[model samples]
Target: MPPVEEETVVFRSRFNRILAAVFWVVCAAALVAIGLTYAYRPTGSVAGLAVGSVLIGVAVLVVLWRPQLTVSDDAIVVRNVLSTIVVPWNALIHVDTKYALTLITPQRKVAVWCAPAPGATAALRASRAQGTQARAWTAASDLRPGDLAGTESGRAAFLVRSRWNTLREQGRIELGTAGDQRVQVQPHVASIAGLVAGVVAVALVTILL
Candidate 1:
């Protein structure tokens, strides 16, 4: 059975999904073209190339679709490409978006891959678009590009910060108690292994030719 989200705020980049869809369509078209070429004049080289291309395409698609961030009452679940990190609200110390929208826990800092900060070009354009995300944060007066309401990082950080603030105000989250709560990091070993195998298959086919 597939996992389902119930009473959770799940955030994923629509751009990533659309891009992966476009790439999959292209891959499908390429596969059709490969089949036609094989029918016209079948060759081992053609088969190998087709196989390699398919593997490479699949690997790329996985990368596009992997990252997401989910927020529930108790925790923020960050699903990056290689691993998933679960940070409970009680254990969270601060939220930063210097590079990416990150959760600053006592033990380690976890960056949200899907919510990467805007680069220089974007930052330059963001001055006119700044909002109140930084109002409660450390650098309340000075805003980074990622702290702007229009950015990916800012949007994600808002969800986290909003809930965290509510918890703090309600007296549910205590200060200096971060070490008492446990943060879990789960590596996506199967996904990693599958991607590695796919790359190896593609490389072997390309190299043999």
Candidate 2:
């Protein structure tokens, strides 16, 4: 028989999506407002357009673009705004959901930038509900309970834990082999440098004009 392919799961922040949408809308409105107020004066209009571009660029880079957590049978991928980190299943020691979806490995702890845990009050409520659901989780060990899936961070942690347990049972995760290979964190240095350069160039032009 052919080997079964592992399933891939993605966890993303609901609040972050809403926040990103708001940022995008705000940037669009700012640009529209600048265009509507465009005067005949070339210098003033150019400066206003430059300011609008700067706002759009900053919003796109910072607020409108958020991170994501992807879990698969073999590894977990953390896609932050400027960097991406890939960690193998065997390297993950624990999944924590205190302040965020944090992955604890033998070498270091990585926190997911997008999925932030709820506040104390909300978490307490979710925890109480999760406690009840956790007792019934044994029968459907492979599935995530609805109670525990209240928040993005909680859901991400639960998925990671479930995959970790499944992999361990299948003897796919070798704890002893952890830390043999370092996790890879790749930053989008060129993109960030270009953004910085654009901002500086616009600022210099605005000043000179």
Candidate 3:
């Protein structure tokens, strides 16, 4: 038996990660400010505000920092806002980036939230900044904005498609396996529950104030 060699890649929105980093700094400062304010003049409203602010900040961080996709030779783990999708390469039928980086399988279509298709303005900027070049895995027009190699969705889709094509050509993906396999989709129940709780706490604090 031979060891499985792996080359894993993780992708996230650069803008979102930067925003999360900035928000984390703001949260740290807010905590310090709240602590100082509480020490100086202990008040119930101040306590309420602190609690609400913490809850709100944490909820915001989860939204900003958590969405990502991890790719390996075997599968792709897509961590969306509300759910996660595990897509094995054998189960994939095609890749599409109409709205986002999407995986089409026999069972369903799964969208990768982190790799959203660039809007017209963003796409135009990308095209001008880096020429609208067609990726190696695709023969579509260079002007196909969503399929252009410069955009986020296009980049992710290219990785997925390239890997799939390699496996297909090498005969690693079994012919009948697609019908037998299903991609796993799981909801982020705990995260969702905590977010809901935070929202309720914020609402209660707001009402009290």
Candidate 4:
């Protein structure tokens, strides 16, 4: 028998790119404003420039460069701002979307940082108009109409469930040993700590001056 080809699916928010672009624009505007202000009054305190730098840094870290979820043949990779988590398909009991995309295992539930569900109003609207948007909804037995067609998190979950089902049907999913069952979460402590320290330092300087 021929081996089944594995497909890798990536789920990301459509808004992330737009928001990142906006962040960059805001950062550039801030820099230009600071430059013009400094040019007009050379004697002005450097606090303005410092403030602009902090703003840009925060925006870049928090909004512009956010996390994304990738579902591969072997595992689901969650790339967060300060952490990365890889959960094998065998380890994942199910995928859930309430406020965000969550990977459920027997031991724990891990939430994805990038994909967030729609707000209450939007969700209600989505529920009411579920069947009308068949084109947007991906076909998956594990996925709800509100989820697969309604929100970013839903769509991500659908893709994940679809792939999982395929693998299971092909007898590719296997029960692993204790070590393999554990979720792999790697945190970028240095980057997160540095950002926090920088923010605190800026705050202290702003207050002291």
Candidate 5:
């Protein structure tokens, strides 16, 4: 037998915790200022003032502290507010999407608790450089989460599916469901949109109130 090609690389979803934190901080500060200004205003009601202040504070904390997802060459990791889980590819038996991507493994099925995975992060990075086909594997965007289940190198494929399932639950999970057995992971704009809308609402209320 001749030499075999192989593609081995680890990939991770981006973390928005810092951005979330900053957003919350700014909102909180603005809300506090507004609350204080209105607290003593002759035209403001005590109930309205109190409600706005409390809601602003709580929203800041909650929005700023959501979960995150981590990926690697052999596993899909989910880090939530209170826990972290690492799922191996082999354990992932089925991967489906609905309200979110659901991962069914031999052990059990669990929701992913992290930010959505970006489209082709690994493939984009990999393509930027030139290397062997690494087992003659095609571009990742051309592979589906289920197709890998039947392969000898299905480990990585399994992880990708698990990650997709996890993301599906979060919101609109974008995957290129094209070709015979190919699934393309696409960037999800809804996650960012939600975050922005939430921040803007809080900020505007804080500043204008």
Candidate 6:
């Protein structure tokens, strides 16, 4: 029997933009550092100049080359320098934050890492409670659950959670074990970065020598 598929909302956080920007800046700095080191050193060691130039050039290319993610009705696509992946909603048996969890489908699973530890959870809860209390001192108190839960964002989260629970009940998703079906999440990106970095390093070395 063909598996019954349901529509899924692929939610992406806005923080990725900030992360990309930071990475780009770092790449540029690394490149510039290599160029400067080659030009200014007292002892013109050809070997040092070659190595530095390569490192800097590679850094520049990595920053300039950015990867993007896209969402559609049928699948979530991740585009990187080396490769692209199209994971269908039906195939995505689960989605969890990075760390200690694996999204499982009947056919495959994705490994997640670096999730928040228990201490982080407790701190967040305490901070939220403190913020709520502080806000209650003013007339414009935070919106109560009744007011917000009916709103679109709140409702969406509720629906997603409910559906995820349903999937858990159906034995489609599990909490532990990295599944056997190993999918390379970003093969193309890694390959491209490595190649570009290598070429840039070689170019820098030639220029300095």
> RMSD in angstroms, all models?
5.3, 4.7, 3.4, 3.9, 13.3, 9.6
How many backbone clashes can be found in candidate 1? 0
Range of the 10 consecutive residues with the lowest summed lDDT in candidate 2: 138-147
lDDT tens readout by residue for model 3, 1-209: 53344588888888778877888788778878988998998776777778866876777667868998888888889999889999988888778888888888899999888888989897777767664343323345433567667788878877787777776777777887876787898999999998899878767775665
lDDT of each: 0.79, 0.72, 0.79, 0.73, 0.46, 0.45
Model 6 pairs whose backbones collide: 31-56, 54-201, 82-188, 82-189, 83-188, 99-113, 99-115
Scored against the true structure, residue 26 in model 5 reaches a CA lDDT of: 71
Off by over 4 Å in 6: 1-16, 26-37, 42-69, 79-83, 98-102, 111-186, 189-209
Error of 2 at 202 (Å): 4.1
For model 2, how does the per-residue alpha-carbon lDDT over 90-203 read when each residue is reduced to its tens digit?
788777766678888888888888777778676556656668655466236643222257767767787888888888877777767877857889996766776677777667
In candidate 4, how many clashes are counted?
A: 0
Residue 51: error of model 4 in Å? 4.2
For model 4, how does the per-residue alpha-carbon lDDT over 11-113 read when each residue is reduced to its tens digit? 7677776787777777777777777776777532446465647566575666446678898887889987788888988888877887778889877788887
Best by TM-score: 1
Deviation in Å, model 6, residue 4 alpha carbon: 19
Question: How many angstroms is residue 198 displaced in model 5 relative to the true structure, after the best TM-score fit?
Answer: 15
Question: TM-scores for all candidates?
Answer: 0.83, 0.79, 0.82, 0.80, 0.37, 0.43
Clashing pairs in 2: none
Candidate 5 residue lDDT tens string, 1-209: 53232234342222445666666677667667767776677333433444455555554444435454456434556544334566654455565432234455655565553323224443344433334453235444454322332221233335565555555554333343311222223333455555456666655655555
lDDT per residue, candidate 6, 32-123, as tens digits?
77566756763435445545545544543443334443444434554444555555445565554223223445565433211111244443
Candidate 3 wrongly placed segments (more than 4 Å): 1-6, 33-45, 132-143, 206-209
